[model samples]
Target: MASTSTSATSKDSPEPSPDVRVWLGNRQAVEEVTDHERLAAMTDTELAQQGEPKVRRAIPMKKACTFLNIPGGTPLLEGVGTVVKAWPHMSDASAPAWVASTSGAYASLLAEHFGGVEVREPEDPDVMHGPYTTDTAAVAGETKGKG
Candidate 1:
């Protein structure tokens, strides 16, 4: 006579059999992911060739000397860090507004030519200022009020 016995499995015993259908289903559901490390590993030449990321268009450097009415022959590298007063957007040519900046001369020129407003960048004083929202309204109002 054949006899059947049930015994407890050992701690090191193999796990029960897995369902092939579930395993296959899971395999099909698994998704592949590419991350930053994989992206960074790519070479610059490869990146440029592949055109993965968009390249930003560069803006032309604003020249302070030209705005300052300085001659081209004058050596003014020292002025890069110095605060120069400028009014980049003053509509009135004779009565142009003014502000302080590293590129004051340029700002002033812009004011005389374009008539925007005075800009003062205390942190980076070379920046153009004024064209401020309130300033625009005030300036336009002033112009209209005068007329």
Candidate 2:
């Protein structure tokens, strides 16, 4: 299954561009997907192009860095073994916790999904200290704290 994300704005495309749908693991997007039927017809190569993933706020991770698996859902990752700090989510944890932060794939996924994982800049220690949620604005014209 392809993971569709609309947060990615085309770098070269101009204003009011349509949202790009990306495949999270591949760290890429194929332009134009309005439904599952169309998306399902795309070839494997089309599904795996080098399109950019969206970055909100936080340090961009590198290929060599590591990440904690907080959400732990679909597309299971092969971790480095043993639970590390589940920071910004929990203190204590269980197995299969950390995974390679390859090409910022996992970091991008967490950022997009608000999956409770982050790679903050080491020099900037003040950005994240506790649980955080991205974008206070909710869907359907509803603000986070309001009805």
Candidate 3:
């Protein structure tokens, strides 16, 4: 049967793994990306075994966003009040925003809504419902940057 697990990221810097090493744009790390063009090239078994590069960072993704784009006062749902309390600075519509979901059309749409912004989150296989097994990942795993 399929199972799930979680683990804590070490406070130290990211450690190296066989997979490519870099940071993703979104600040949830994504889960079940399973469609990146690059990963498509890998054989089923290869892709399954090729888990994300192991990483370590003291701060969690949510904490990274605690101060980001936060409004000075309570946020308004709609109307001109929204104009005054928006994120990334209410005065700058061009300031920028980042979406954080599994890589796919939903994420794409969210980015497009923000003028094709992009993902700003990261995923921890240990925590975010994964550490996907070779069998479970036989055909997916294509997100880029940090996983």
Candidate 4:
């Protein structure tokens, strides 16, 4: 009787790993991308040069506002409104880039790192939501009249 032994080698290929779905973002939205060509196109020079490339997606306004302890619904000044600025944290060596809107309402968000600069108010003053005002007088009158 002849005895045969088998050994696994490079020639015996292992099971392929699953393709990873990469997330990318621009000004509009976050999206999962699978195509290599699309990913390559989305990648910048800094990201492309790395051995293990990583992408940083922009965070949503609500999340950023929450993180910075600012009101989410704060209206931005026109022309300066809706623009998000991201820059490296100069004070902290380990910190990631800071992101904030260009609106004056959120100026405090970046005050520590950047010198407080005066941001212009919206051209149309009426564009912003007015301060909260309710018909409390009507409720008081109804209660008093009933009593």
TM-score for all models, in order of appearance: 0.18, 0.18, 0.22, 0.18
What stretches of model 1 exceed 4 Å from their correct place?
1-101, 122-147
* Runs off by more than 4 Å, candidate 3: 1-97, 124-147
> For candidate 3, lDDT tens digit of each residue in 37-89?
55656687886898533322232343222111112122112211222222222
Better model by lDDT: candidate 2 vs candidate 4: 2
lDDT-superior candidate, 1 or 4: 1
> Highest lDDT: which candidate?
3
Candidate 4 has its poorest 10 consecutive residues by lDDT at: 138-147
lDDT of 2 by residue, 1-147 (tens): 122223334566554422221111111111221345545666777667833232222322221122222212213122111112122212112221222232244435444344443444322223222122221221222222110
- Cα lDDT, all candidates: 0.27, 0.27, 0.29, 0.24
Candidate 3: worst 10 consecutive residues by lDDT?
A: 134-143
Prediction RMSDs, each to the true structure: 33.5, 18.7, 19.3, 27.2
Candidate number achieving the greatest TM-score relative to the actual structure: 3
Q: How many clashing residue pairs appear in each of the predictions shown?
A: 22, 0, 11, 0
Error of 3 at 63 (Å): 9.5
